[model samples]
Target: MTRLNSAATAETQQSWASVLRITEVAAGLPSSEARRPATPAVVTLQMVLEKLQAGWRWVERKRSQQISAKRLRVAETISLGEKRTLSIVTVDGSQYLIGSSAGGVQLLTKLDDATPNNSRDERSQ
Candidate 1:
């Protein structure tokens, strides 16, 4: 508290000095001074949130568009079960097999499905 009071007193005394000509002070002013406005603290927070939300929406739209491109780059295998099934794949590299055995080739379609790709053969149905 004492330290703050001493600093305040020093600052008060220092303000008495006109350290420069008015013209010199005007010339030294930063260019941004002309753009300054008396914005309330809540107004500043609102402006920041608006900018953040706009950027978030732009990112979401861009990310959704990239899904198909990323899907094209992936080449994964699908499996069918034990009776030795055979299938045909589409022109777009999608697999389709028609076979039904108790333990044979299993058809895998989505990437998020954690099916076994190691023991599968690649002849589309």
Candidate 2:
């Protein structure tokens, strides 16, 4: 009877050890339902520079800065009163009539923009 009891006790210890092993493995593994999807790696400026060193030309990725080409030019001016005057100014080929008085400056009207193409078209006509 003592030998039978000892055999049963050994089997119970083995079963408990197997249960502890299963618990440890389950704890170490990440849950499938809770796991997040991996995202793609982002391209950095350093990566771009490395590619450029390898003779890769970056065209559109680097934007070309636009320098201001428009300049204000007074075309014609006429006095309206003692302190008031109307001046026609051209900016980037567009003409505008501006009024200046003792109070302040005000935009009077917009005239037809005079471009080289328009002048050429007029001369051809």
Candidate 3:
């Protein structure tokens, strides 16, 4: 009788372990096969250097694009008097004479592509 009881207990424990394993699978836990160690990633110095160079090239390209996109620039500025000044600004391909005082800035005139003397004459008039 004791022998039979021990056999039954062994069978019950085996069935319980199997049921727990099935429950774990249903709950999306990693199985023994999926828990195996993954292959190590191999990185070389050449790989690292290549990645760094590509990153620098991208940064340089972006910097050059930003510089090229600048269409407005102050060509020259002159002080007219106290709190007053005159400036020549270039936008795209056109130049403009700007006046700045304590109150605000004003666009005096657009300078032409003619000689500097002619531009000055036009501004004076």
Candidate 4:
């Protein structure tokens, strides 16, 4: 009976000592450090807007380059009067003379490697 009493008393004292040590450690820390809450990193609105603008500019530049690098381009257009027009279109390095009027569009001719100084009379056709 006496041995049991002593063992119970020792267990209670050991538990109280552990509690006191924990309290002392907690007290040693700064109040701010102990109470600070965990939070995600903050991002400013200006920073986000700047990033968005940079991305938009990049997209616009790429779109412009793609448009300018297309395989087909109209080199020149001449109005023949009375709603008629002739257009020189370049496709994959080849040039074509197209005639358009109120009737419809027609492929006038496929121009050879002729310089721009040379002229052709469409009236003959």
Candidate 5:
């Protein structure tokens, strides 16, 4: 097997990461102005984790909690074969199993009242 240069490998990885970000942002653009193919909004692990952690931080900030005792922790990680995996995470007293795969990332289940209530605000089609 031919050996790949370390610098070349890192450069290629960086280029792909940049391309992925560009594609993500382009896809986020309005349909009329978008140059990429139409598809469902891509939700990466980073996005989901960020949203989850942000919500917690917001609540903590609102309550004027100075000490950073409460923190999101990954309790366990289980591979469900293939590229799919289940992560059990906890923050305060709440726990959730987040499923991540090539298809998408979703909350398998959560022991908390963190779900948003938007149905009452939604307008009928």
Candidate 6:
């Protein structure tokens, strides 16, 4: 066999790290526009861990090829220390939290999207 290139070795290492990273999971209702808090919201680190795990599990299920398992969207995204989120409540009320806590909106995507609260109308789909 040919010798492995440095880039290839590095890429292989990266993949393992991603696959082995612990996923945290948490629960927190979105800060509704109607219920925007005058003060900051405080959630425990434990809660954050839960949400992160859930988000990672969500991605794993999606990326997996198994047919005997399924994971539904539960929350849009859970928040990290920064603005990054680990979970999220998708339109239709199902959350679609993400595992990678690196960037993007922490708790929402679009305010206009209609959810289960609506009739799946133009409000959000």
TM-score of each: 0.31, 0.35, 0.56, 0.52, 0.33, 0.22
What are the per-residue Cα lDDT tens digits for candidate 4 across 1-125? 99999999789657655655554554465888767653343125334444555565676699789998999998999999999999999999999999999999999999987665553544344
Residue-level error in angstroms, candidate 2, position 91: 0.5
Ranking by lDDT: 3, 4, 5, 2, 6, 1
Candidate 4 error regions (>4 Å)? 1-42, 117-125
Off by over 4 Å in 5: 1-70, 112-125
| lDDT (Cα, tens digit) per residue for candidate 3, span 1-125 | 99999999789657656655554453453677457554343224334445655565676699789999999999999998989999999999899999999999999999878968888998999
- lDDT per residue, candidate 6, 5-67, as tens digits? 877866865764454453211234445633754333334554555665666667667767554
lDDT of all predictions, in order shown?
Answer: 0.49, 0.67, 0.76, 0.74, 0.68, 0.50
Q: Candidate 2's residue-wise lDDT over 1-125, tens digit each?
A: 99999999789657656655554453355777327543333225334434543332233223222224437889889997889999999888889999999999999899876765899999999
Candidate 5, 57-101: lDDT as tens digits: 575586666455658888889999989999988878688889999
Error of 6 at 121 (Å): 62
Best by lDDT: 3
Give candidate 6 misplaced runs (Cα > 4 Å): 1-43, 65-125
Higher-TM-score candidate of 5 and 6 = 5
Q: Given candidate 3, what's the lDDT at residue 2?
A: 100
Q: What is the alpha-carbon lDDT for the whole of candidate 2?
A: 0.67
Candidate 5: lDDT of 45? Answer: 48
Arrange candidates, best TM-score first: 3, 4, 2, 5, 1, 6
Question: Which wins on TM-score, candidate 1 or candidate 2?
Answer: 2
